[model samples]
Target: MSAETPPGASFPESPDPDRTIEHRTPQPGQATANDAHTRQLPYGQAEELGFNAPDGTEGAPAKRGRGWLLAAISAIVVVILGGGGVWAFSQLSGGGTQPQEVLPGNAIAYVRLDLDPAANQKLALLTIARKFPGIKDSLSDDDPRKALFEAIKGDSPDLAKVDYAKDVEPWLGDRAGLAVLSSGAGKEPDVAAAVQVKDEAAARDGIAKLAPGDEYGLAFRDGYAILAKTQAAADGYAKAAPLSQNAQFSDDTSAVGEPGVMSFWMDLGELADMSGAAATAAPTALESIKDMRFAGALRFDGDYAELTGITRGGAANTLKGQPVKIAELPASTVGAISLSGLGDGFATQWPKIQQAAEATPDGQTITKSLEQFQQLYGISVPDDIVTLLGKSLTIALDQEGLDAQQPNVGAVLTTDPVKAQAVVTKLEALLAGSGTPLQLAKKPGDGQLVVASTQTYADKLGTKGTLGESESFKLAVPDADAANYAVYVDLDKLEPLYLSGLKGEEKSNVQVLRAIGLSGNYTDGTSMTLRVLFN
Candidate 1:
């Protein structure tokens, strides 16, 4: 497909759109690839798979391995993602149809959008987004979907001639999803676009205007029209299992909790294999996490937009880290990220990681180095280091920490006193040879250890602080007490750091950002939530 996918809020798709590209009739030749990296059609794989003949008629199905079909399918994936922004999601309250219903059960990845979301969702987003000039321009006065279409087409000349009112509007539905489907063959990926269609005939007609209808494969299921690179591929997808019925997908959706306006899902292992060098690596870089599934959903929460994601299955347990309380930090804190149980988790899981690493080519070299380090520093590999860090830790900063020359910052650690002190002694010995020394001492009561830029700041952290009571801190990380891992930034307070880099409009646009917060937890799997608040 000549068309490129749309771009937006971590919504993976096309490149920076050229607002200056003028619309004209598409030329009739092998379509010019929008990007230099995009491969032209793979001829051998296409025919080997028995896809449609050049004139657009079906060929016999090939019973070969998933590989043959996979390569051809990879090409199909481009179209699946062709209308990237077509699915710009909006979310408020849940309960609209999701596009996963029409996607294949064996899909490797997908990015979907809901142009029109629950009313409350839209209202909430616009309310805050309007304060920023960049987003306000996209929130057009005309129908948003129509505005989105124009913007999408403007990104590529291949779609320049397709009018939104005449071609897309009549048949286009509210939801659209772009996806890459796998045939379970470990072969290349194929792509498809499930466009929710109001009128199939109108959709077919409109599609014809975009490309010679025969060049594309079309299939219908439920109320959506599935578009593919070939008629044969389209027909196969029509008969194949859909994601809605996939148990793994269902479980993941549940694990992530609520559905939002936009969401994305992908198989980490499969995606890694697609990388050119990784495909040829001896064991593959992501071999350890190949089976892990990563998914994210976006929605509006009062004054801010929240994005939540999770990594589950295949080595997901590696993410197991306990939560800790951060409400006691000083109210003057401008930034901090705190997490608990990692020291314990690290101790528990390091052996498994070491075993896996041993299988690599550099195993012996690593072993030798660790042996030397342990002998020289008189500290065990992970034991002493992690013990010194403790079970719970918070890396925090206040205004004083922002100074370029000599900043005031510190790390709060809650740990076992006797064992940690032993490790601390080892660390102190290790640092004794260095020119610059750090301050590390215990806090008064909370069984905490503080490592600071200055001993004064370390002393300052010994008592309870009002961080939890600060407005920006409260807004950014309200769930801190219940969260195991959290990060907060007072954007307003930090504005001066970057204000010199911005000018007029750019500076004004940034001023509206009040703060940012992120919180996450791990049980059997890891899930994280992030929010960016606007003033």
Candidate 2:
């Protein structure tokens, strides 16, 4: 989240011409600006000022060379930085670089970012909340909103204390600080700012006019940033959301732009900074991306020392060595809003999570670590990573269950083997209709029941003959009753049952609930009877 330049903020002076190449990437799409704002959050009123979180792609410059081209450069940089050599790769290919070929089944990653320290801190505050379950009480006693204020105050201080041109760009991934660059302590607005321009000639002419920090507004809420299109087409987007009719067009002609243009196209360095930040932060956010199963791409074509391109063939050939590229694909944009104290957001609802984690092998250990991470960072655990953990436990149990004729999920527990087998026997009998609805799988651990049961549904839909592994709680009965149970079901295994009950388009409803359960419990002449609810 970059700083919002006050409307009509003065542009800073331009940089050296040679270092500053003329940017001519096209801006497509309507330049529609949203006036949306969130409800007054604990963070502050700044969030209510209607600055939507910019799409992650706002910073990736256009692609300019073959895939390996960037990777090849990074390799050289790594070597030079390690005191190997100072040679930088400058393999200039003809024309513009083509989009790297996307392979089938590859994942998409979208990255969203802002150079505004306040925004980062806003997110950081949320991250911090996850780590410290109760931070509101930790605020400075004098200031009611001291925590929020401190987070905002920490974005960037003393621009002169830092080299905006050098450190800021590298730090943020794009030259995000360019917007605040100063040629003199105080000076004229050197650059004109606008996002979209319809006039082909104005759009063409405008590219030649952009300075380093000049703002390029784009028209995306949250999606991939890598765009595949011609420069002219991309420029047409500026027309959709013009920076301003008052924006200076040419050094020679002060022509205004068309009215219908939008404001999505961002400055090259601005694009780079946002993209770079996203790239830099990706490793840390891997858990979230995996949980959401997100994927996407970003395009950049600026003088970024950090970004490198790698060719597909070149990348595959250099397998023994570190691949020429770092990570290929656009930054993901699934920004997670902190939900620490929404009455019953996560704090109250997590007992079920606690119970589930405790029942599995070392579930408490992993969950505790997750809690610690959140407390420290105020961020949520990525669902994909959590799912992975869940699946690992499931697989371990399933493998154990399969070892015997009519396997019991708990028999695999090596700890307290006696109790484990006893629970397994009880569970198997219940599942096979020979015992009670609830049966212990093992002794209670930590404050959770290590139990299992075979419950049925109304013809239990969604057994696509595949019986995908899906699980959830079986609606808890209040007042500390053992009847409050959670259940796991392989959706792939249950798809056929769900399909049998559905007719035509109704089958699609099951698709959304593919990984979850149904609304109620009903008896099916199958091995189990249980309840399925979205919650």
Candidate 3:
């Protein structure tokens, strides 16, 4: 059977084989064949016929001229074929460069760009725009990819004339990588990049021609061309152990998928230290995070793209376990989140919190409040707060009244009922003189404490439909028991609450949020995942 042809396409019939001609020597005195036909004749046959001469004379001048022409054509063909092969091989093997070799051992974060990010990003935006017919027409008629290329050309006119295939690709290599190095205290982090190249010498010559006497340091090692702020740094990167062999990086990469397309690794502890140095008001939570590593990858699958990552740290263990099934919330629920081992997480970071609190004026005020509470209630505030709190807590929003305009926010805390009661009574008494009332009611049967903005809302908590049984919630928060912390947001119900406040382009963005659900799971305290669902 003939291969299927696309609609509106026609398949031409096979040519008549019997009509093909056989080659033969032309008779003397016959009209000279056309230049095109003479060129197609075999070199020996053409020579014997003296076709190289204007007349039928066998002259050395004509023979030499014809020989030189044939030699030049053959040379051109060889170069074209050889260069084409190299280009094809480079594309198929993802280039010959080793990005890891050009990154320093002390690199805190490493990022590899497998494809042209600008092009990919444009394509992603186009894909999203196409998915929503309401917004698709709002997009520019100009292709985003072409627009980006034009923008780049506008910024660098010289680059606009450069040929990527002949001038850049041969030297720029397969993949490009960037490494973030921790600069000692009081210094900015250093960024270094590596480009894979086909030939180090040729790449160097090309780079020199492209950007002569540029300030950036450059070095060649293995199949990579390294560029950094300093020559020393670039040299060190060339000699240092690559990220592939680095134990910490390997650990993080294992948790997330191996590096492909695009990948990144971040050291949380180092990042915390950097933050502390950069900002005096850095959060106390950063101090508790020990040996944390986060790694992820961005991969494209046909029209869709996925970003997957994992977080692992010493504090992860203290933050493990799913305490409540978020899917049990009612369909009217806009959002629900359950966090297990909250107490443990707080306790683990309590020392850091105390240090931070002692250093700040607001923290001093909180400390004074604790002292006053102790004096009045004869209770150790810190000990009581920790003891009275539960290992898990769940906060959820449910529609209130017939209009569903007001959200009835409720929090369920799992703690010792007797201790919770004591803490509640003291809190209520403390706020009594301030004119604001505080009430914490106990949920029947579950022994969990319930707090709501309104008493009517609190009263309905026990009788409200559970969100965990909802189909949308179930699909969003799959394997709730395996998660240490989980959160589900129902955009279907939540969008209307905030959509009215948005205008112009912001209002159009809300359309993308419709029927969208977001769910995240911190599984086994060692890894975390966030999944987005759309109806």
Per-prediction TM-score, please?
Answer: 0.73, 0.19, 0.63
Rank candidates by TM-score, best first. 1, 3, 2
> For each predicted model, how many residue pairs clash, with residues at least 3 apart or on different chains?
9, 121, 12
How well does model 1 score by local distance difference test?
0.63
> What's the true lDDT of residue 3 in model 1?
27
- C-alpha lDDT score of every prediction, in listed order: 0.63, 0.23, 0.53
Superposing every Cα of model 3 onto the true structure, what RMSD results?
18.7
Q: Give the per-residue lDDT of model 1 (tens digit) for 1-535.
A: 1322112322222232321111212221112222344222211111110011111212222212222223223323222122121123322122345678877787878877655544334445445555666555444333445544443343444566778888878887767777886644445667887778889899878767655423668888778878787889878787788887878777776666544457788887767665443645545345656788888877654456678899887654644555566778888788888988788778877886787678779998888888998898889868776776677888988776685676768788787667766777677777876755544654534577776767778787766788898877776775677777899988888887998899986788889888899987787677788888878
Best candidate (score: TM-score): 1
Q: Where does candidate 1 stray beyond 4 Å?
A: 1-97, 133-140, 155-157, 212-214, 239-241, 266-292, 312-320, 418-446
lDDT of 2 by residue, 257-326 (tens): 1111000112222222324444554332332222221111121111001111111111111011111100
**Runs of candidate 2 exceeding 4 Å displacement:** 1-392, 395-411, 414-438, 441-492, 506-535
Q: Rank the candidates by lDDT, best first.
A: 1, 3, 2
Candidate 3 residue 69 C-alpha distance from true site, Å: 46
